[model samples]
Target: MKAKARAHANIALIKYWGKSDENLSLPMNSSLSLTLDAFYTETEVEFTNSINEDVFFLNGVEDKNTLSKISKFLDLFRIARNMNERAIIKTINYVPTAAGLASSASGFAALAAATNKASGLDVNSRELSTFARRGSGSATRSIYGGIVEWQKGINDKTSFAVEIDDASWDIGMVVVIVNREEKKMSSREGMKSTILTSPFYKNWPEDSQKDLKEIKIAIKEKDFEKMGYITERNALKMHATMLGANPPIMYFEPKSILVMQIVHELRDKGIPCFFTMDAGPNVKILCRLSQGEMIKNRLMEDFKEYEIIVTGPGPGVEII
Candidate 1:
């Protein structure tokens, strides 16, 4: 059986900082994200009777470390379908890898879609989200299009994402890719370290929940300024927890700080933009679609070395 699928990467508006059950990929706080059109992953899966083990290829090159993770991910589908066949999976990523771009979210969502199709599982989107969550926690949100809210369920059955808004309004994201190399600390390691050592970590979930509620209201009102304000503050609060850790973990570089200041300058000039960063040095700015080019042009003046991509909301995973 062979199946091919595509899924887009998502940026967390209200971040999912820590996990309650790491093994199951369950998060401590419910998260919300905007799936962007600029970054995505396409995957093809073939389940064959001849192969003895699962194999993975990324951008035409075989990756053993990635294969190990995918193999385990495939087991969920295998166990459900009662299939012993091995799979050959090839993934092509449009987004830069390991640059805080949510590549794994799209990667695993695509894998879950392709593998489920190959195994003859015709599940609903919620079930699909649950399946994807087992691979990467953010993958749950990647299963839906536009603005999605991932409810942090107490267990596997209840944990899934739902679309909050179509995001057809005049809103978009400008991604500033400062570094392409992998980060020193992985999201998982950074999250666990912060959770265990940072006293500030205790209030993160509560603050994130409040942001989630307020942001939802802002989205319903279609108030871009309100949404941007809350998103920026929420992202800053997430990074604050990392700094409070015993052995402080910081994600922002010099360029990241500069970009943040530029966003503030733009806001002061009445451009109405806000910046958010994940577990990396890259910065993403949320602004009105009409102001996208202006923001891009302004960013180009100072950061000539970085890559800036402007994109709007994207659709959910689909079989192709």
Candidate 2:
């Protein structure tokens, strides 16, 4: 039996808001993401001579369906590698249960990496990304150790993620978990609705591409201000797609907007910070290392009980 492992979370800079083909996880546009250290998943695969299918675990609890998903991931990986044998996968995520931080990106990324190790499959990041993408939309970004871009491949053959940079910058993510209540709509459903109903879906072609370009330049220059501006606006625009839905739903609660206000007030006090929200109310504030204290102070004033999480760039999957 071989035990292989992987690590880290990948935060989107240029988010994947829509998909041309959901089954292939083909994005409507290219997106960039940062692999972070504060959260991640680990996986191990072994070709059990006696076992028949895959197995999965979170912390220590076993889940059959979850195991099946990992099995799907392994099937893709094995096919990509043209491996002679397939195996069972066992994985665990270290993040808190359903904190909205652990995307399937980390899980599938770790799983693919582990599968490669366990089966002695040698493949490049691009191949790994394509394999991982078959498992989850976001996992492609997790193939690289730092910032990565997942190009919306017209089809599975052309679609894959590529490394953008090492992301060894001073930027940090201040996660504000609002609603402490999870959104009933999963990110996948939100994307479906946006694609089907949002009039702004028309605007994505221009706006999303603009964000991708500016973010790429910002990373090249290692400029926090430029990076923050592009990320915040891109995220806001992504959220706007929800309001354009037929029923016009919103993920933001009153508290979610309040959290953004807290962020702005902090900036007014000369704190260097900008916030971005995903499909839900939780905000991920991008800030500089030196500005982290001031940003936290302002967040404390508004959210006294809520602790602001501090995280930096995290490397991709490797041994624990």
Model 1 residue 247 lDDT? 97
| Best candidate (score: lDDT) | 1
Each model's lDDT: 0.93, 0.77
lDDT digits (tens) for residues 35-57 of candidate 1: 99889999999999988988899
For residue 243, give model 1's deviation from the true position in Å.
Answer: 0.5
Residue pairs whose backbone atoms clash in candidate 2: 6-317, 7-317
Which candidate leads in TM-score? 1
Give the per-residue lDDT digits (tens) of candidate 2, residues 1-320. 47677767787978888888878888899999878777788877776656555656656677776766667667765675565454656667865435567558888888777787676675767887887888888888888777889888789878898888886767677777665666688888888888888888888966898889988998898887888888888888887878899878688778778878887777787776888877767778888866667677777778887756777777866754
Off by over 4 Å in 1: none
User: TM-scores, in order shown?
Assistant: 0.98, 0.92
RMSD each, Å: 0.9, 2.0
